[model samples]
Target: MDWAEVGTLVALLAAGALLSGFLAGLLGIGGGAVTVPVLFQVLTTLDVAAETRMQIAIGTSLALIIPTSIRSLRAHLAKGAVDTVLLRQWIVTVPLGAMLGGAVANLLPSDVLEAIFAAIALVLGLRMLIGKLPFLLGRDLPGRVGRTVAGLVIGGLSAIMGIGGGVLNNTFMTLYGRTMHQAVATSAGVGVLIAVPGVVPFVVGGWGRPDLPPFSLGNVSLAALAILIPLSMPTVKLGATLAHRLTRRQLEIGFGLFLLTVSVRFIASAL
Candidate 1:
């Protein structure tokens, strides 16, 4: 990349990292919804092939989310919000699902991935906009079989969408009568599981692809991961602080709007 282009990419990545970090703290999301779209645009500017750009974006987003999710997880853990029992139950299945999801994503067309992301984002957006689900599944979380099934679904979808499992996991938990705080905290753990194992398949899948940018491994862009990880680290703490201060209702509305915006952007890109 030219010096000017490098400078521009760094600036954009910094901005994206900052925003994503804050969101990660505030909402317990891995912030991939925001980062993926921006990275896709940036990668396009670098003339990355259409076939690989979306995969790179998703991989890089998941990679960057590792540190962000860990930080958020720690923050919530301190506050006694995370659900250890639930996390234990999901540990095995979630990673398996994530790996499978990444493998699946490697085979799919970029347009299809974009459409899937858009649809998932729309669901999350509407949930946020409404502030609460209109219905409840039950008063308590499901049993082993149910959780395993949920874990697979969450892990798979999270890998495909390049998200930490926060958004969906939180929604699921809340629907089962868990508080938002607990759901968000636990979702941070979910993000770790998704991002960690999820990175491998993508890297393997994209290995030796001619269209990838420099310092890339498979579909994961090392340059973007480098830029996003450190920059996002501190901001996650700031976001978590802010999260603790906000009313649940306020957080819901903000997250909902954010999802709507990102989903619409992805949909537009696909068209």
Candidate 2:
């Protein structure tokens, strides 16, 4: 690669690392929101083909998330928020869900994947807006059934979309009575479900895809993960510590705005 290309790649890595670290704590999300968009945009400018762009973007994004989630999970665990029992259940299902989801995504055409992503973006955007209401905060709906069903939907979506599932898990857990801290902590566990099985098919399905990027494991790209994971680890702790200091609404407002921006971008990309 030329120096110019090297410089741009480094810039992207730096930006991705910083954004993932910052938002991981601020939004209680896993950072795919930022990484995928940035990678997509940057890779496109580099003349990467669309055929493998989304796959690598999603794969590399999730790759960073593996470490990011662990770091973030550690912070939340320190604050006494992670629910071990609930996390156990996800362990059983997430792998299967992620693997299946990746396989499905591989089989589908670009338009289908794009459509699904667009739909998810709008729903997430609406969720971000609606979840901010006073009624939505700390609201308790009593039932294990509801939580279980929620787990299914969230996990399935996570694998299919190649996200860590933190946003959905955080939102649902909060709606089901988990405090903000608990929700964030618990959501960290959601990445395991996504990263493991999801990655399997991402690689298997994208084996021979035209114009695939360098050092890719299936559809998942390695270019960004090499830099992102190491940086995000310690920074996640930073975000978690900061979360304790920020007011709940302050965090929510920031998170909501972040989601809104990402949603708009995804929708536009799909269109």
Candidate 3:
């Protein structure tokens, strides 16, 4: 690419990293929600094959989550808002689910992945937008079997969608009567769980593929990772700080609107 194009790509990556880092802290989402879409656009600009673009984007997003999630988790932990017990229980099941999701993502078409991303975002968006409906399943989280199931689903779906499991975990916790702050904080921990193991399957799946972009390690783009990781890290604490300042209702509305916008964009692309 020309210097102008290179400059543009760098600029875009920089902006995306900053925004994502802030979101990671602000929403406990590990910033994959922003990273995936931004990486996809970057890959497109580089003329990456359509068949591999989404996979690469997702894989790269997961890799980016590793440090950012850790950073975000720590920030939340300091606030004593994280549900450590819940995180402990999900340790094994969530990783296992993430692995399964990465494996499944390898087999699915890009459009199908997009659809899955869009559909899940749509549901979560509506749930948040509706603002404390009386449809909660219970006043407390479910038993072991149910919690295990929830963990698996959260890990798998987050892996597939290139998220940190924040949105899903946050939604799950809030529905079960946990406070939004607790849900958000716990979701940061979940991101670490999903991202670390989640990256392996994607790398293995894309190994030796001929159509990948430059500087790629399997489906994970080292170039993107390099740019995103550092630029994103510093902003995470800032977002986490802001999260503490916002009211639960405000956070809910903001998250809901963000997800809805994302869902619409992807749904249009998928169609």
Model 1 local distance difference test score: 0.89
Question: Which ten-residue region of model 1 has the weakest summed lDDT?
Answer: 242-251
Give every collision pair in model 1: 206-218, 207-218
Superposed on all Cα atoms, model 2 deviates from the true structure by an RMSD in Å of 2.6
Candidate lDDT values, in order = 0.89, 0.71, 0.90
* 2 versus 3: better lDDT goes to: 3
Order candidates by TM-score, high to low. 1, 3, 2
lDDT of 3 at 225: 90
Clashing pairs in 3: none
Q: For residues 1-271, write the lDDT of model 3, one tens digit per residue.
A: 8999999999999998998898899889878878888888888889999999989999999999999999999999999999999999999999999999999998999988888888888897887788766778899999999999999999999999888998788879988999888988998999999999999988999999999877888999998998999999999999999999966577678868888898899888766
What is every candidate's alpha-carbon RMSD to the true fold? 1.5, 2.6, 1.6
Candidate 2 residue lDDT tens string, 216-239: 767777766777777767677778
lDDT of 1 by residue, 174-205 (tens): 99999887888888889998999998889999
Model 3 misplacement above 4 A: 248-255
lDDT of 2 at 231: 71
